[model samples]
Target chain A: MNAIVTVLRKEVRDTLRDRRAVLSSLAGALFGPALFAVFMNFTVERTIDEGEAAIEIPVVNAADAPNLVGYLGQHLIEAKEAAFDSREELRASVRRGETEVGLVIDKQFGTALGEGKAARVWIVADRANASAQTAVARVRGALRSYSSLVGVLRLQLRGVDPGVARPLAILNDDVSTPSGRSVLLLGAFTYFLLFACFLGGLHVAVDSTAGERERGSLEPLLTLPVSRGALVAGKFAATAFFMAVALIIGIAAFAVAVDYLPLAEVSMDADLGLVECAMAFAVLVPIAVLGAGLLNAVTAFTKSFKEAQSYSGIAMLLPTLPILLIILNPMQPTISMMLVPSLSQHLLITSIVKAESIDPLYFAVSATSTVAIGALFGLLAVWRYRSEKLLV
Target chain B: MIEAEGLTKRFGDVVAMDDVSFRADDGRVTGLVGPNGAGKSTTLRVLCTVIKADSGRARVDGVDVAARPLDVRRQIGALPHLSGLYPNLSARENIAYYAEMQGMPRREAGRATRTVIDRLGIGDLSDRRAKGFSHGQSIRVALARALVHRPQTVILDEPTNGLDVVATRALRDVILDLRRDGRCVLFSSHVMQEVAMLCDELLIISEGRVAISGTPDEILRETGCGDLEDAFVAAISSERESK
Candidate 1:
């Protein structure tokens, strides 16, 4: 135990003095939060701006339907006189993306309305253009309302009640809360936190194993009167320490970055506060042990520092796989899912951000399972160290 | 003291050490002189507990290397073929790290580190990080690190592989000092002149086997050679012809 502590202290002190390692860890921790802030801010601002802005549609024959155009104007749909003379031209313009949607009134529209016959109108739009769908919907809605108003007036003229014309009323009920709406975006927050934790220990893990061997220190180091298990344990502990630090920093940075996001503008509440951050840190921190263990185990197989670095780069991506799968096909938290390390932490973090009550049983299972697997990897590293092949 | 009897280690089909036997005693410098690829390093590695011999008994101060490697490691200090130091750590810290690993208390390790640094005459270079150290400076720091624990036996593999005239002389003085202090010093060298100058007992190895081992004069007289260098060639050639 004393030997373990000695090796741990030496490794940690040596890593701290390495400027490149320290800087890389710091950079990784900050990179995720800064990117999340910028992306969230852009998305929130665009959604809010698009919600309030008026939509414009070019009308092929605006003069023929002054009254109809006037009604659309009241619904925040502006009608501009189009340069084109025919409906074909309007269709081409909409298809070319020069206009989101175009209005084309039939040549016989005025006569048909005078004779009390049905009049024709066309809304030219490309349904596949996602950005243009909003304008198309707005224009279609205004036209329908105008048609209903005229029909209601016609019913009154005939001394029939307007209510008799409509037999059904439809309403929409949405159940998602403000915080619940933000959980999808905050899922990324947990991913970044986990990634930062892994990154924090990468240098130390590679340095202690492959770097030590490459520098010719492993032989001398193994010659010391300490058990290989104790040495591995010490190195593992130091790596875990750095990872935990990075996790803390990531949680704090995300907490601050969340405040700058305009989630409220989109009716989404970012519940990432001091308490939530603390909870998240607690939930995600155990994976650092797993991260350190895994990294050390993988790098131990490499022959040189450069080879270990490249191999570890790929190894670090393992944690993110479960997160990506969960995001694409979300599942409710279950006992079996808690058995998986990164997936369990992700579910817990998502629940925390959504402001849901966490089950202590789930936390216990998740934390215990994660640490158990981490210890297994730690033991694997020790086994590798004990092998004579390690010196080769 | 270090002893190996009928030690043999093989890497797959290539035998690295074959029936190698020798004794390095306290209060004397024993040189394992061989050309590159000979078993000098392999023998040292086995004694230092870095690797195990396949088919023989090796002991450091009568502690079996295979049965009790940790105990054997405690009895010896080794400088490997490469002067491996943590580039980011100062020379003092490097030495102290080894001292602590040897089970010294923190304060005692620090004191021991200081003593070794001063004794090696490397106090001026102790505080500097090892990244910028020249080969000579690195060797001195590595030597200090190895001696910080003051084990009964010290094993160095090619300690003077690359050193200037001044550095080599300084290293010779340190080796002599270890002998005077009654510590067993076992070092390997490929250079015949270096082995002739420093070795109180010499073991000549060729092709993974001991060709001849004795005092310089004894080897010269036995081989009917006028000097140690010619005796080394004659012993190696005779061993090869017999094989």
Candidate 2:
């Protein structure tokens, strides 16, 4: 234990002294949450602002479509970016990214609406791409609701009373925790954690091995009374400490980002209080351990500093797989799943995002297994230390 | 005390060492001098128990290097040909790290680190990272680390390979000091002059075998040469010509 402490302390002190190491750690911490917050703010603004804006369409004849397209145009801006006469050019323009959305109001649009016959309205878009798709969907929905209202009003204007046009009415009474919430806003926080873990400890691990060897300092280390195992343990501990510090900063940034970022005004389902944020931080520690272990072991095995760094980058890629999977599927956290290191924690992380309780058994398994896996990394680092090939 | 009895090592068909044998008393410095590729480092590595010998047995402090490998390692300080120093650590830290590994107390290890660095005139450089140190400074730190715990025997492979004039002389003085302290100092070098100047006894290895092992005077007399280099030339000339 004393040996390990001595080794760990040396590493910690060295890391604290290197300016580049600390700066990179802080950069890794802030980068993710800041980017995610910006993305979230943009998403909400796009939805609300676009919903209130005008829908663009080309009315072929002003008199022809008095009913649908003509009526809808009154409520939206009509941007005449393309001519309706050239079908091929319109299609090419959409394909070549000339426009996000396009609408064509046919010659018979007003006549068909007035006579209550079949009316054709064409919607043209360049690969909807979520934002454009949402705008199109909202615009189409508004037109449909307005048409029905106009139809009922026409009946009232003819002979019947306004209330008699519609005999029955439906009302939505939703007792939501937060009304009109976006799920992505909650998910951005988890993504931020994943980003911070894999990138934080990479440089230190690289510098400790290949950089040392190339500079001719590694030989002196091996000659020391310190056992190779102790050396590895010390190195692994230092890197893990750096990663943990980075992760803590990351979790804090995310918590603060979630709280202070304009998220209060936007509706969200999951709310992270002080206690919940603390739990999330507790979960991040084991993940940082797992990350630090793999990074150190892999870095030790590599031939040079650059090689170790490149390999560490590849190792970093593995953790993101679980995060990406969760983003695509968004499942509840399951502690029983132990196929990946800290995957069970990701499950807990996902639960935290959805405002669900963390599974205790899964949490225990994740914590135990991640710690075990981290020890295995230390064992591997020791094994590397014992090897003449790795030492060279 | 160190003893090697017909120690042999081979990689498949290529023999690195063949029935090599020698002894080093507990209170003397024994030098191993040989040309490049004469199995000097390989023999030292086997003696250090860093690698296994093929057949014959050897011992460091009466423990078999082959059979009881870790026991031999526990009693020996080996400075390999290649410097394995960690660049991030200072001279003191490097020495302290090794001392701590050898089971020296933290306080004692710290003291040993200071003593050696100051002895080698690297006291001012002790706190600086080893990355920028000259080859001489690096070797000084390595030597300090090697003796930090004072193992039963010291095995150095090409210790002064890259030393400048001043550093080389300083190293010779340290080797002499270690001998005065009565520690077994076994060093391998390519330079016969260094072996002649420093070693009280010499073991000249050639063609993966000890061509000569005796005092400098005996080698000079037997080979009919005035100096150790001439004796080496007189002994290995035929072999070199044949190759």
By TM-score, the best candidate is 1
What are the per-candidate TM-scores when only chain A is compared? 0.94, 0.80
Show model 1 residue runs off by greater than 4 Å: A113-118, A159-165
Give the alpha carbon lDDT tens digit for every residue of B1-243 in model 2: 889989887766777787889998877889998889888978887787666777888888888876776567668887888666666678788788778767778898888788777776778778888768888888888888887777779899999998899999999998888888888999999998888888888998887777778988988888888888889877767545554
The whole-model lDDT of each prediction reads 0.91, 0.74
Calculate the i-RMS of every candidate, to one decimal place.
0.6, 3.5
**Candidate 2 docking classification:** acceptable
Considering chain A alone, what is the TM-score of candidate 1?
A: 0.94
lDDT of 2 at B131: 66
Candidate 1 per-residue lDDT over residues A279-307, each given as its tens digit: 99889888998998999899888899999
Q: Model 2: iRMSD?
A: 3.5
Report backbone clashes per prediction: 0, 23
Q: What is the DockQ of candidate 2?
A: 0.40
Provide the lDDT at A380 for model 1: 92
What are the candidates' individual DockQ scores? 0.90, 0.40
Question: What lDDT score is found at residue A159 in candidate 2?
Answer: 78
- Residues A1-392 of candidate 2 have per-residue lDDT tens digits of 67778777766766666778778878888999888768777866766677676656433343454455445666674545435555455656667766555666666776776676656666666555555676567557756777678777677768777677568888998755551254555655656676676667777777777666765557545544456776777778777887877878888787776666555444654566778778887776787778777888888788887788788888888877777787787664443465466566666765666666676776777788888888898788778867766643
Q: Clashing pairs in model 1?
A: none
